[model samples]
Target chain A: MIRRRFPWLSYLVVVTGAVLTVVPFLDMVMTSFKGAGEAGTLPYHFLPKAFDLSNYRAAIDQLDLPVLFRNSVVATAVITGSVLFTSSLAGYALAKLRFPGRNLIFRLVLSTMMFPPFLFFIPHFLILVHWPLAGGNDLFGRGGAGLTVSIAALAMPFLVNGFGIFLMRQFMVSIPDEVLEAARIDGAGEFAVWWRIVVPQTRPVLLTLGLLTFVQAWNEYIWALLISTANPDVMTLPVGIQFLQDYVDPTRTMPIVMAGLVLSILPVLILFLLLQKYYIRGVMLSGLK
Target chain B: MVNALTPTTTERAAPSTRSSSPAVDGRARSRRRQAVVAYLFLAPTLLFFAVFLILPLGFALLLSMSRWAGFDLGGIQPVGTDNFAGLFADGSTFLAPILTNTLLFALGTVVLALAGSVVVATCIDNLRFQGLWRTLYFLPIVTTVVAVGNVWKYMYEPGGLVNGVLNALGLGSMAFLQDPDTALPSVVVVQAWASVGSAVLILTAGLKSIPESYYEAAALDGAGPLTVFWKITLPLLRPSLLLVCITQFISGLQSFALITVMTKGGPGDATNVAALEMYRQAFSYGRWGPASAAAFVLFVVVLVVTLAQLWIFRRKEEDA
Candidate 1:
């Protein structure tokens, strides 16, 4: 009776909150369509005077959207692919393989999650800058820009995520030993067994991990900013968009920036919506963010 | 029960059987083969950790205790605790506003997010189309901080949606980011708004676990919604609440990317936090030594808060 009565209050609150949450995104879209002086003016207009496509053109021309999109896709693909491959490989070893120091290695993998990522920004950059023989550096990691001048710098530090490995291992632990043992006794190598049995069974988790990594790598800004500051050719979408806001006058270019944001976020938005089930499961499993 | 019993039975039978010596040798060989295969599988990940993780920690530690111009490794001057000392020296903002702002920013976000999530989660419990509402709330989480910060920054302008609403509601337009007083809180509001969805997700899970019978009994007893909530929901929801609180606090403390996107710790360090200060010190000013020291200081703060939460949660679990 309590649940049935006065549900109007619940509807009002939920709908209001949902609107508030969705309005900014709607504003971003509408503002993207807004013309010069239509946005960020003394009197706000929710709808644009005319639905303009010029901002989209201007955003592409000014921000080099194609290059940025290419960089973003490459980085995201590399990260997602590497994370999935490494996580599954290492997860299989930890879950099923018998070895000395197995427990110690698993503990180490778990402990890696304890270190906050901010701690690594300085050292990771330095290590990349000093990476020997990559970007004209000497064997002793000196006399050159090292790897920072290359696109790999954007994807290097994030290649192996501890949490991905941990998530994969936890899920993989449930696979019955008999499944692998049966394959093993039938003359299949460990690699064959893993590829044939374990990999197929773990597809759902792999998709979840891949989506999570893809979204994160796509949205990563600060590190991309740092790397692209060294070489602009590797600038991802977020970095490129931020670069516009940093240098270009916002009053004149706010709409273009908004347009760029709309375009930039579209890929992730579409991917997330399409695969939200897997991604949401990933979040529920992570519980940390 | 059978599944549970099989593992123990197999374990007990393994050592009791004395198989042939050749079989034992074959088992040993297979075990060695498995170990080799395992290491082969883990090679890439382990190598990455050795270079990226182990090496970086040692390097950061060395850099913190020493001074480097970020060019020549051989030129690093070991200065002991001087970098850490300089951060706390008189006239340093590291101790006063930056660290202070960091704490306040984190605490404010946690409080606002926790409150908003509790209300929304509770209300949402009685609603239809809950998934739709949650997905709507989750839009900002998926969007890049670049988009989130810029949209919010524009909205903070006098001609933006927020101020327009203020005017419509008979309130004066306020300088959200320009004024030092409101800058931090404005950013806090955005952060809370962005994070409230996840908190709600957690709290909703918590809410669903509280038995409906409690509410039924409360209704029969003529208790009000607020009272039933306080007496039943809040108490049962403490675990999830604390989980949300501690995690949000930790992330809030570490977060500066949105700040970088929005204000860049501007208005004369009014919104500056420790992590952003550390970033500026290293990247902008090229003060690698002090920056590394700042990183360590912030790391210790985060570690202490995390450990304290764990301790408190453990104690609470024991009590429960």
Candidate 2:
């Protein structure tokens, strides 16, 4: 009775909010199936008159889904892999090893989080544009487009995440030093101990960090948008979809855009559903969206 | 720099040669080895920060203060404080509408999301299948901003779902995103909608930490439900509430992705925020100096607002 009150008012409010939250997605799906001239019309219909499969094909063809999908997959994989590798390494050093300037380095990691990402967009773009010896640029980074034309541009700035390092170090701190000492006495090297003991011990946390990094890296828009604008070869899914949305005739292509959006979000949606516990715990720990 | 490596090499060699006391020497050698290994582990991350973080910052600082219109890095001509001055130089739109719109957008999102999440979180706490309900709420968050923005943008059309509902209720259809007055609010609602799920997640955790015995005591005292909520739940939920507000404010201040996707700061800059303006200045018009200046200005605003929020919350906590 204390906790399980059947407050019908609460039910009404929650259900109403839930319906409001969900109806847009339903509208998107329904609108995706609407035939030409059916969408964005007078007296909006909640359901489509016909279940059209042509929109999906049009989206796939017009957006070049395969290339965009490949780019996105590669970018996400590179970012997630690099962040995991760097964060784990830096985190192990910060948490367990006693090196000179350890506290200073840890504080630097924390300070990096406070500087917002928007501050870096302009300069990061410029740096990529002037990155010494890539994409026909000379050693002075002149006469060429530099790294902006490369596929690595999408994943470069985000390869080392300060928050990921912080999260990893916080988790790794509770690992007993005695176990590490035991391994050391047993002739295990530092690299072996970190790889075999520290990593396996922090599997769940690593998963949480990895999933957080994955979703973030996958859905990254502004940087990807900038890079894709510089060179179309590295366009990720969101950038490609937005490009279609902008350049194509919206009246005819709205359904196609919706189709593309649905396709783009499917991977993250499935992952979120499957591993929400880890994702939620990640959010709780980081307090970041 | 070359000389600095001399001591490291000598120190490393000393660990092996100081074998007068074998046991102490062994421990010292291991410690030295561990330090080397730690430095090895930290090398890549430190290198990344040096190139990506520190260099970009110095470059941004230079660009913000200089006038470099084109792609030529060497063509930069330093014009100290002029870019910052131009942002507020009488004819500027930076101070009045863009920054003002940023504040309003952020404030509107925080209010709408906080109210919505607080209600839903408290209600969900009393309900079964909380995980299911939470998963449903979290759908928008996992989805990309392009999807969220476009779906809602389509729904905000004259014949869209919102206007359709209005028309069904015998009201006239409003041009939601087209008009200057309604454009910012329309985008604000979408921003609030997209962010409410995370706020709910945080608030639910906050609610779970509240002791159940407090509720029982309130029940024994014959206090009503609303009273219990006002007195007990609201006060205890302050920290989570502050966190949600600050994070939302910070994100809301700079998040032009949704704005870019939905309205693109349309209807004559009705929905233009500082970040978007900065983006357009750099990318669209090639005004690198003013764009980087705008970026710095917006960063300062974010920093000031966040610190002010912390101060206000801390003071309130002290008073309480």
Candidate 3:
């Protein structure tokens, strides 16, 4: 009918949505480039009068951004690796293997998903304090807070994700049983089957989980702030940037904060660009059920 | 002939007996081996869960029942339900407003994001450069929330870009984050903007899953665009819509970074959500007992709402 004849209205809607989404980001970029004096001016200009890189340079110096970036990278990498390794293995077992208490274990893992992390803050903090690692006391095991003030603490809490296990299990269940049976018939060991057979088949899911884990760990703030308070060297990018907001002099530090924001954002943006297809697939798969 | 057959049959039978027995035994052994390997593979994940999730959750419950000063190592005295009671009594001053704000914010965000996503999804679904539009719409979802919050923090600054645009359009500048009246709503809008991308992605997938024949048939029936959308598109999209609602609710309730960065529960606690309030109590005010109680409340709220939504959706699906 006439409805299908002209779709320009649809095009208009797309353009409007795109513009609405893009404009704020463009503004952020422009504001970052603007001088501190020009930042507070009314009728905000889309383009800076004179572009400035001083903010980036100053922010790098002021925030000690290199240290923060390194800490974030190390923590995020460790956490992501741990989560991927642990969750995939658990997920494979849950989906493929017959074991006693399999359903019980699966249910327990799923139940963990419902428990809000905030509830555990006080005790988890105390647990970290009394952990026998770096902050442990003179009695060795009795003395220290373990990894509390170290980068390890940042990675430790999120090393196992119930959601990751769930997602991986769902993906693994979709694999054809014949393929697995063939591997078994070929005299492949279980580990070998998981490594050579299941892992290869499950790369997409792994990558999806990896990206999600990386993003979550990278953006995490509160836990990082709480656990890493004793060691400035272990502070992450989000916490570092947040501290910069209040620590930097309001007048002169605006640009530096903006630069920090830009630098902190670049990795995720680059990641999305590189893996947009898989990201979208992951989103659809996880979100739509 | 009988003598020759006996020799051949004996030779064949001996080999078959020899081969089949080992094969069966090997199969059984390998089955046990497979189970062992599976458990081995699962050990690391199970260990992690036991230590971090299970132990911490159990300890957290215990902590919620005790009194904890900021630095009390050996002084976690059992206080029974005092913390929970204290939280509920005077907690309303902080908790009530925060809860109300959170619910209001979540409702606003879910409704706006859903509408915007549907419109955008429908538009992109019909577009020629579909991937380009999808990427454009999805850009915000990938950008770190901290970065988004920071940028929007600037955007919401008094006489900042948002106000500048308004003033340029002959409207006066509004204190988007400073004024009590506008603060939470402003945060809600920002959240809605950040969230629409993911919602759009899901809705787009939902739209794609609708068979082309339905639309074709509807076109043959002389149905208009609105009529087709109402009758055909929406009915099929119930599942995705339900998902979007539940996810948005959870995320909104858990929202902290944006509020912490943007307002810090300011303009006289105008935008203090339960999650942020928990952070404030535990970290800022050093009221561990009260904070734990608040956190438990938040956990309960999230759990209850999520289950209720799931149940409602399940019932709807059953009826359909």
Which is the better candidate, 2 or 3, if ranked by TM-score?
A: 2
lDDT of 1 by residue, B60-80 (tens): 999999988858888999999
Complex DockQ, candidate 3? 0.49
List model 2 lDDT by residue over A1-289, tens digit each: 4555656877887889899999999998988898899988896899999898899998899999999999999999999999999999999999999867899999999889888999999999988888888888899988888999999999999999999999999999999987876676566788999999999999999999999999998899999999999999899999999899899888788999999998999999999999999998998898878
Error of 2 at B215 (Å): 0.8
- What's model 2's lDDT at B60? 90
- Could you tell me which residue pairs clash in candidate 2? none
DockQ of every predicted complex: 0.57, 0.56, 0.49
lDDT of 1 by residue, A126-171 (tens): 9998999889999989999999999999999999999999988998
Worst window of 10 by summed lDDT in candidate 3 chain A: A133-142
Worst 10 residues of 2 chain B by lDDT: B1-10
What TM-score does chain B get in every candidate? Answer: 0.92, 0.92, 0.88
The TM-scores, one per candidate, come to: 0.96, 0.96, 0.91
lDDT of 3 at A227: 67
lDDT winner: 2
**Could you give the candidate ranking by DockQ, starting with the highest?**
1, 2, 3
For model 1, the chain A TM-score is: 0.98
**Global CA lDDT of candidate 1, please?**
0.89
